[model samples]
Target chain A: DVKVTQSSRYLVKRTGEKVFLECVQDMDHENMFWYRQDPGLGLRLIYFSYDVKMKEKGDIPEGYSVSREKKERFSLILESASTNQTSMYLCASSPPYLATQYFGPGTRLTVL
Target chain B: SQQGEEDPQALSIQEGENATMNCSYKTSINNLQWYRQNSGRGLVHLILIRSNEREKHSGRLRVTLDTSKKSSSLLITASRAADTASYFCATDSGDDMRFGAGTRLTVKP
Candidate 1:
């Protein structure tokens, strides 16, 4: 069974603080993604990594950055957390050439 | 930008009834997928239909895709209370996949 695990199920941070959300997958997938879910925005991709040390920005990547130093781990970093960044953060991974992405339980981030 | 948009943002149905939701995308896609998310949980991959295919089915879920119209539909038969969740449609193009604002389904027992 493919499993994706997030570092935290919930988190709260103050404005201007740095935040990090981690995701790990056991399936050795080549593609990993980060997204933020809002009430009306759905899942908007923040960043994606196709291979180790390779990253691509999605539609909304201005306030976030990503790290993929290894194949099994992907991390999302917020330079300066703001209230507007508070949302349900999700991580997903998929095998090479596969469109089906397995997701980890989201982290509900609250930036106060 | 969002690629897919689902119609009927919210739906309410009773147990044993069939529920249907529609999704329309703006661009050509390689494949379309359906996902379900229970409250406060991660999204679960439900089904995937390639652009060349018209319909596919799982236990109680049926998905139909229309490439020419750039749209798709998902039908859940004999929906139970456990089926209540937010259903999302996603389109895959190249290496990128985008999701639509989901349709929240409420099944009243």
Candidate 2:
């Protein structure tokens, strides 16, 4: 079975603070993605990395950045956290050429 | 706007019944996948059907795809209380995958 692990299940941060959410996969997948899920708005992609050091912006990438220094890990960075950024953050990984994604337990973030 | 849209945003059914969810997309896709998300949890991949394929089944779950109509349907037979969850449909358009808002299902015991 594939395992995707997130660094935190819940987090709280003050406004303008920098926040980091980490995700690691044991399946050695080549693609890693970050998304924020909101009620009624659905799951919107923040960023996705196809390979180490390679990143691509999704539909909503504002105020967020991602790092993929290694294959097994991916990190999402909140440049300046704001209340509007408070939501559930999801991390997913999939092997190359496969659209089947394995997701980690989400991190519920609160920017107060 | 490659995001798929699921019909009947929410549905409630009695156990032992069948529940069906429909998904419609705007663009062509390489494949379509279904996922189930328990409350406040990550999504679990349920089934994946490629564009060329018509129907596939895994246990009690049956998925049918219609490329010409740009639609797909998921049927869960003999639904149980444990089958209650949010079902999302995703479209893989070769570049990236886009997800829908999802249909929330509730199975009454």
Q: In candidate 1, which residue pairs clash?
A: none
Per-model CA lDDT versus the true structure = 0.96, 0.95
Using Cα atoms, each model's DockQ against the true complex is 0.88, 0.72
Residues B3-29 of candidate 2 have per-residue lDDT tens digits of 899988999999999999999998989
Candidate 2 lDDT, A2-109, residue by residue in tens: 999999999999999999999999999999999999997789999999999999999999999999999999999998999999999999999999889999999999
lDDT of 2 at A97: 91
What are the per-residue Cα lDDT tens digits for candidate 1 across A6-53? 999999999999999999999999999999999988999999999999
| Model 1 lDDT per residue over B15-100, tens place | 99999999999898999999999999999999999999999999999999999999999999999999999999999987589899
Assess the local accuracy of residue A29 in candidate 2 as a C-alpha lDDT between 0 and 100: 98
Model 2 chain B weakest 10-residue run by lDDT: B1-10
Every prediction: chain A TM-score: 0.99, 0.99
TM-score chain B for all models. 0.98, 0.98
Looking at model 2, the pairs that clash are none
| Reference-based TM-score of each model | 0.98, 0.98
